[model samples]
Target: MDTNIIIVFAIIIVAIFFFIWGKIRSDIVALSVVVMLITTGILTPAEGLSGFSNSVVIMMIALFIVGGGIFQTGLAKMISTRILKLAGNSELRLFILVMLVTGSIGGLISNTGTVAVMLPIVMSMASEAKTSARRYLMPMAFASSLGLLTLISTPPNLIINDALMSGGFESLSFFSFLPIGLITLSLGIMILWPLSKLLVSGKDREKASSSKGKSLNQLVSEYQLADNLYRVSIGENSPFIGKSLQELNITSKYNVSILEIRRVQSRKRFHKPVDMKLAGPASTFQENDLLYVFGNINDIMTFVEDNNLTLVDTQETEMGRNALSVSKAGGMEFSKIGIAEVVLMSSSKLINKRVKESNFRQLYNVNILGLRRKNDYIIQDVKDVKLHSGDLLLVQGKWKDIEKLTEETSDWVVAGQPMENAMKVPRNHKAPVAALIMVLMVVAMVLNIFPTVVCALMAAILMILLGCFRNVEAAYKSINWESTFLFAGMFSLGVAMEKTGASSYMADGIVSGLKEFGPTAVLAGIYIATSILTFFISNTATAVLFAPIAFQAAISIEANPYPFLFSVAIAASMCFASPFSTPPNALVMSSGRYRFIDYIKVGLPLQVIIGIVMIFILPVLFPF
Candidate 1:
């Protein structure tokens, strides 16, 4: 082996070690590899830095913004809600629907975002069906990976496509991989659906079977505040409309406490309501301000009647309460609201501070409706009580505000059932415009009206200009910079591998070992190798490193390179065997209470089956 090849091999091995060790961020490890390659003269500074300007990198960043717009505008949530409604009570039906919906949506949006959006819905379905969430969660996570069947489904798909294009192959059109993707997705659902029943523990099944499900109101009553918690709105003729909470002193005068205030501005008739702010001393009453108050029922009713405030009934009916509801001004209906249970982390900053002292409402924009410490539920006088680690808080606010709380994972973790109704808030009138932009971007790509990168850039810009995203900062924050840098750095490493002939050398070794076994065996070997690598590394990084080798291997055998390239793309996305393999997998790990062995037991067989199917299918599809 050449000295430069030896050095390149050493760098690659060290980089892989750091990636799996995970003591350092993957992007940082990749950048360090780039620095080493530059210093060793394996790559020029320009070559090392070329990845930053790669069109694929730019496209990935733009796609993140587009996906964020879909999320912020509640389009994804709407789809999830509709799909879940079709699930009914059958566990089998729910599993099939979840896989279909999640896979289809993930094919267009970010898989990570798809999983995040669908997670609460799936959990709620599991609860309604009286089964363990673990049974459905793993399937949902695996299904999300099916998005890779589309050209724009996941980053790895795009990386592989770019690699093929860079090697002078024709770029794949949108939906090119749909046939393979649908086949694998179908096979997965067929295999995993029955396996779930056998995998979930007996204790979980017994709990589901023995227990009669509880309603939202019944669950709230457990906190002992069913009678005290009332949703009342300030009427247009109310006397307290202009007064602040401190000035009105309703807590002392009426023996009722204002926990949260929900306000809707009438300035923009079609705009979604802003987050419900927690009622602090400085919060002033406004017309139609919905107040969640805790107090004596008689006192609250009397106070409402005395002030001409409208009482909004939130009783859980046979149809159950909608997670997101919009009430007009002057109507007795409640606005978009939600109640969530949050458990403070051991290192939470809110620990050791009274609710009032912590400015909990002002800081998090959520009201502390009740607190649970061990077996006791503190509903009355909770504001003065000091919070502690492991304390559970029942908070009430607009669904958007509660959603914001879920983002603060370092301070507290959301516990118990998710407030699904909260996710169904009114879409900004601009939601249609956002959806239209996304469609046009796809149409543009399919028609080749513009380069894929340009089309993505246009869609991202439209998301902001069309009001789907609130501002540029939101669009900016939506980009996962870590993944962006990681892609750029890995691209440089890929360049080094090609420039130093390392990829060709590896390709030769693979072709030599598998030549007697024929091209079918070669394709299977490459697929298996890439699949194993992705089990430990970022799928995008794995695709970047292996794509060139696959292309070179196809060339060595004097066969079409498309099958080899497709194998690389498909293999890189088959990361179901480890939770740490992908973000979607990790996101569901703790929620499902899944162990590493659970993934192996379920994912290993699926991976093997998919590999076997792909080896036979690839040559047929691409004619290698």
Candidate 2:
């Protein structure tokens, strides 16, 4: 191989390794590849950096900001709530509705954008429906994958469509892949329908619990005991001490339901609620009954004040009332006191540390309410158990406390939302306008009213002018610049491969091996191969790598390249075999609290189903 070819392959090898190993951040890996390509003379400085200016890169960056704006304004949240309410018939029906909504919206917008917009919405609705957020998140992510069946659905499809035209083939039109894509999408959704029930089957009985750090009094309007209702404060020295509600006759005599209660004092010592005797009804009504009664507001107030039974002050409550509904909103609105699920990594300081010995609450103010070890859920007095690697903790605390915990215990990997502040997405009203502009631009481009790249550029410029990006920093930060660099680096690598006959060399080998197996087999091979590549590379890069060869193969067989090319596009875009396959997959990795094995277990089967549908349906629509 020539020096340039050697350099290109070296970059490819490093990129693939980075994707698989993933110890380093992906953007850094991409930038390193760009630097290497430039340093080795494989690409000139301008050529290596040309991806920054690539229309696709610019459009993607702009769309990310627009998507962020949508999230900030809660537009996506509003839409998801409406859709979910409409999906109230059945799980299967709900599954189909969610899939259609996600795929349809994703097709018009970017997949990552679609996911970002819908993530909080999906989690919230899942929580409301009393389902595991993990069960629904993967399906939502898969919907984004399936949306890539259309030319405008995702960046990769648009890039590939343009590349086809540049390569002397007719550009794919709107809904070009609908027949194959919809069938594949429907099959994948159906496969996922049974998954929610399967994974959460055994854990169904444990309802979501309330956190103790905040008070519930702040959540709802309060009323006091009514007039003519007897009122008494049970002091530590009171006669009714250690009496349960049944023993006290609270309901029969006073008609008091004991609506809510909170401990009057807290202990520095780690306390565990054991048997009903230790913490239950026998525990007795403590000082400050904090009783709420169903009666006239005026009457209740008069009775409580008259009897000297004071209402609990906001500061005296365990948790603010506003935070009480975290589970109620289905996971959407919750206390700012952050809650995260962390796993004990092999390197964590928490490994082998007993919860009591660790003093997590005092040190970081983070409460470890529960844990999941293997398949068992531990909600007991967990102070005794030594933490182990891979142990999952249900930690609730302030954002700063969570940050400290993550930093101090490297072995404990925080699953969702970094300790760092959320990125500042532009919140101006113009963002929706910018999004509308982008939609109009895409429509105009598809209609051949203007070049796709040019239309996208104009929309981006208009967005900047409209102050959709607050400043140059906002605009610069909005785009995933690393993706651009990766494209540039890979474009050069692809060029080098073509220049050195590496591409043709590989294509000839594949063709010769599959020729006897027929074009259908050859086509299937290309689809599967590209899909595998996508599990380790950018979808666009995967398309760029295999699209040319697919086109060439179609020519060799004297067939139109549309069906073959469509297969490559859809398959490459559905890189669901690993968490590293796509950004949405990465997002769900932490959000869904999923393990590597979980992705393989769920995604591998779904990918196979989509591949089968594509192979069987593509030829019918486009005709080989």
Candidate 3:
């Protein structure tokens, strides 16, 4: 073997060791490989940095933002919420719906994002159904990968597509992986049903309560404010139409707190989600506006009569009055509004001030909605009550503003991380726009109107430009920098392996060993090898290393290259055996309270079966 090939191999070994060691982050390990490659003269600096500029890397970053847009706009929540309703409280129905819905969404966006947005919803369902979440979390992680239907679904898919185009082979179409995705999902749902039973030990018979932070609904229920909420609408001829909250002075005059307002935009699209705004001084009341108010029944009734408002007898209103109606997530997933508990300190300057006298709306940009003193709640005249030491005041505001309250913890302390922010979905009024952009991107890719990378970039930019995300900072934050660095850095290692002819060396060894059995056997060998490597290496890194080798193996055997490339993509992504192999797996470990043995018992079997099935199915899907 050449000395340079040996060095390249050495770096890969060290990188893999560090990846499995888990003491350092995988991205840092991959980056160390890049530095070694450049310093050893195996690759030039420009070549090492080339990975950062790769179209594959760029597309992955943009896809993160696009996925964020879908999630932040509650588009993902809407889909999961609607589909999951069919399941109700049936465990079997929940299992099927989780697999199908998560897989479907995961195919378009990254599985990590899909799992994140869906995790709370599934947990809430399990809690509501009076079952354990363990039975569902592991399978949900696997389904996220099984939904690799589109070219952008997983990083491995894009890696294979790029490898094929560079090798002078025809690139895959948008729907090329559709059949594979269907087969994977169908098998996953059926197989995981029985396997997940093992997850429900006696300890797991009941869903574990979240130790993180208080959900909005839980806060509402804790303060006994759910019973105080009322939903009323402005009648068409009401004098309140076209009037601002400041003009109405409802808070002072009526002693009723307008917590939230839901408005239907002008000429609403048939299925478009309604618009919501946190009640504020400048908020204008328009015709047919639904108001969510918190106050005494007499006060709310008098205010409604004075304003000529009609009570909206909705399930939503009954839901709040009944139990602070939770969404599929079992939390109040409000977009424009959120709540937090603020405890006043003994030494605080505002200790003796009345609620309204604190000027919280003007000073802190939050409203004092509920006050808890000792065991009793001051509901009738909240703003009139004088603040005392140890008073727990439940404040409501926009999520971002609520989060800011946590930073200044001097005179008062914000309880449990303001916003439980992850559970709050905001700006869903733009879900229609995000949904349209997603459809447009798919159509553009299918029609070949733009290059695949261009299509992805256009969609990401449009998501930011069209108000799909909260702002540009959010779009940028959506891109997981660690993964981006890891992805871009690993490309350099792939390039080094290819440049040093190390990939050919590896490919030749595989083909030479299996030549007598023909290309079919060689294809199976490559898939198994990639799967094993992915156990200790990230799927993306493994795909980067094996993709070029797969192409070389097929070319040497004079066999069709598509099957070989597709095998690499599937094997790299269908890694279920190791919790550390993928982001979704790691994400659920602590939340699901899964042990390593749990993954080994459930995921290992699924992993082996999937690989065997795909090995046979791929050759038939794409002629070998």
Q: Evaluated with TM-score, which candidate comes out highest? A: 3
Report the C-alpha lDDT of model 3 over 148-233, residue by residue, as the tens digit.
Answer: 88888888998999999998988889888999999999999988999999998656634456656686667777776767877889
Q: Where does model 1 exceed 4 Å of error?
A: 18-28, 72-74, 89-95, 101-182, 190-226, 229-269, 273-294, 304-449, 455-486, 512-608, 614-624
Structural similarity to truth (TM-score) of each candidate: 0.60, 0.53, 0.71
Q: On residues 202-280, what C-alpha lDDT tens digit does candidate 2 reach at each position?
A: 5542244444322222211111112212223434444344455557654334323332233434322212111111112
| Candidates' C-alpha lDDT | 0.72, 0.59, 0.78
Error of model 2, residue 6, in angstroms = 5.3
Query: Candidate 2: which stretches are off by over 4 Å?
Result: 1-18, 35-54, 89-94, 108-120, 123-138, 148-151, 154-173, 194-505, 533-548, 559-562, 578-602, 620-624
